[model samples]
Target chain A: GGIITQTPKFLIGQEGQKLTLKCQQNFNHDTMYWYRQDSGKGLRLIYYSITENDLQKGDLSEGYDASREKKSSFSLTVTSAQKNEMAVFLCASSIPQGTGNTLYFGEGSRLIVV
Target chain B: GDSVTQTEGLVTVTEGLPVKLNCTYQTTYLTIAFFWYVQYLNEAPQVLLKSSTDNKRTEHQGFHATLHKSSSSFHLQKSSAQLSDSALYYCALSEPSGSWQLIFGSGTQLTVMP
Candidate 1:
């Protein structure tokens, strides 16, 4: 059994300020991902890392940056926070399945921009 | 671009009632796989079921979903609903040949009332 831990469960940031969210997984999975969750919009992938130091962009990676400095940790930075923006950020890790992978997610970090 | 669509935003059912959540998807690749993920309140999402074989029903924890390749659909269903079943459900698509990414749809929130 392993766990994914996301720091700062609640985040409050000022408009235009840069905000960072961190994640750590003990599963020793090779793939890590960051996703943004908004009300009624489900989850949107922002960035993913296949292994240490590897990065890939997803549909909503425009205002975000991610880094996989170590295999156990992945970090996401909001380049510029938008006014009145509120969303939950989720971090996940997975082991490759036959053709697809099953993801294990963190509790999530909520970002509130004022 | 590959995408998934979950038609229902919210589904409320009484205890012991049948439950169903509709999901549809589109992809250009020849091989396609689908997954159903469940998210409980304030918790991370977890894979509930997955299938790639057409018309073969996959079940887990009393939940079942069948992937219909011809219709580009993989709808989640359960014979009986329970209070513990209340959660947010997401449908996702993956085409390993195209990309090792999982595309998700807007989630359906199911509230199984007692």
Candidate 2:
């Protein structure tokens, strides 16, 4: 079995500051995704990478940037933080991307913007 | 735009009782697929079950959900509730024939009390 690791299990950032989050997986999956989960809200996709250096914007990609530095790593950057923002950012990987599919996720990185 | 709707935000149940969480989705695609994901405290959301076939029941970890294409719904259910079942549940949808990006609904917090 493989595991997905997200760096800095918790993050505290200042408003208007830039925050970066990193994820790495040992499963060698082809698709990697970053999602944001606000309190009481559904998980929203921020960005996704089909392969190394490939990037696709999701519905909630505004104010965020993502990168697939390599096949095993995906990174997200919060362009500007919100003073009261509090959410969990999840990193997931799939062998391939499509329906009739399952995803594996990292433990997640909790962010608290001050 | 693709979207998912979860009717309730919280569902509390007593142990040994039946459980159900309503989920519905809307999309402008021909072939649709649905998913139910569960998230435990401080953990990443995990896929519980998935279905795309109309009226077909999908089951896992004692939970079941059926995709009703005509109604644009895929509600989660279980025969009996247990303490371990307590968690936040999310509903998501994707169009099989189009992009495989998942659109998720606002999650429901389920507390199965003993």
Candidate 3:
């Protein structure tokens, strides 16, 4: 059994400030993903990495950057925080299976932009 | 483009009564898998059930859902609801050829009362 850990469970940032969320997974999975969760909007994929040093743009990738420097770590950076924005960001890892993969997620990091 | 849709934003049910959460999807890929994920209060979303084969029912934790490819639906159902079942549920679609990315629906929140 392994776990995914997200740093800084709560982040408070000022508008136009740059903020970053970090994720670490010990599952040794081949894939890692970052998703933004908003009330009534569901979960939107921001970025994902199929392997170390690889990145894929998701539907909501604009204004966000991701890094996969190592297989166990993935990081997301918000270029400019939006004013009064509040959202929870989730990190997940998964191993590919037949036609699908079951994801394991971290508790999540909540971001508040003032 | 691939997308999942969960019609209900909120559902309230009495304990011991039947409950259902609707989920539908649209994808260009012929071979895909569907997933139902449950998230309790302040917890990460976890896989509740998954299936790929058309018309085959998948069950877990007393909940069941059958994949109906013809209708492009995979609705979650339970014969008896419990207070413990109150949570946010999300339906997701995974396309094997689409880099195994899981596209999620705009989740449904179920509140089971005593």
Candidate 4:
């Protein structure tokens, strides 16, 4: 019965600007992840935190930064916004129960760069 | 590199008919696990099913998927289509014994017609 909440349902940023997205989970999960999804494309992992203060880069982490300040919160920062870089950013949390445990996700934050 | 491929970008079927979505993967592990994730409009992705045992069909909400290790495929199937089933479906892969990280496919959009 846990819920994940992402702040700012929509965001508009200019090129070279920096933006941040926040996520919170009441599940008290130990693992959290951030992903970017473009239209008609598969979601690409940006970063993940297995525990508080621990961060791991995914394939597409060069332009993004993430922080796990506590067990319930994870934040993602766009280092520099790129023009026409519109995508949805998703936050997910999972309990440590191996695979098939199901990942709980937030509604996501939609970013539009101009 | 672990990867997932969903052959169809979109699938359309009449309600009350059977439906299937194809998913394939490439991985070094002979027993790589596969997952089906469903994303409704304006919502985050949710796990529909996940399994690694070959030939054993995993079912959820009347949806089923069987992992075929030899072919590296885990195709989702349903006996009857419903309008509510329309959504974006993603196939994912993960090593059964190695990492908890998941690699996702491009995804398929399912549309059930009345």
Task: Please report the candidate that would top TM-score against the real structure.
Answer: 3
Better of 1 and 2 by TM-score: 1
Candidates in order, TM-scores: namely 0.97, 0.95, 0.98, 0.95
How much does each candidate deviate at the interface, measured as C-alpha RMSD after superposition?
A: 1.2, 1.6, 0.8, 2.0
Candidate 4's residue-wise lDDT over B14-47, tens digit each?
Answer: 9999999999888876655678999999888998
Residues A1-114 of candidate 4: C-alpha lDDT, one tens digit per residue = 889999988989999999999999999888899989986779898998888999999898998899998999999999899976689999998875555445778989999898
Native contacts, share recovered per candidate:
0.73, 0.65, 0.82, 0.57
| TM-score, model 1 to reference | 0.97
lDDT scores of the candidates, listed in order = 0.91, 0.87, 0.94, 0.87
| Candidate 2 second chain TM | 0.94
Best by lDDT: 3
Q: After superposition, how far is residue B64 of candidate 3 from its true place, in Å?
A: 0.3
Give me the displacement of residue A108 in model 3, in angstroms: 0.6
Kindly report which residue pairs in candidate 1 clash with one another: none
lDDT of 1 by residue, B8-82 (tens): 999999999999999999898777778899999988999999887888999999999889888988989899999
Pitting candidate 1 against candidate 2, the one with the higher DockQ is: 1
Each candidate's chain B TM-score?
Answer: 0.95, 0.94, 0.97, 0.93
CA lDDT, candidate 3, residue B84 = 99
Worst 10 residues of 4 chain B by lDDT: B93-102
- What tier of docking accuracy does candidate 1 attain? medium
Candidate order by lDDT, decreasing, is: 3, 1, 4, 2
Error (Å) of candidate 3 at residue A27 is 0.3
Which prediction has more favorable DockQ, 2 or 3?
3
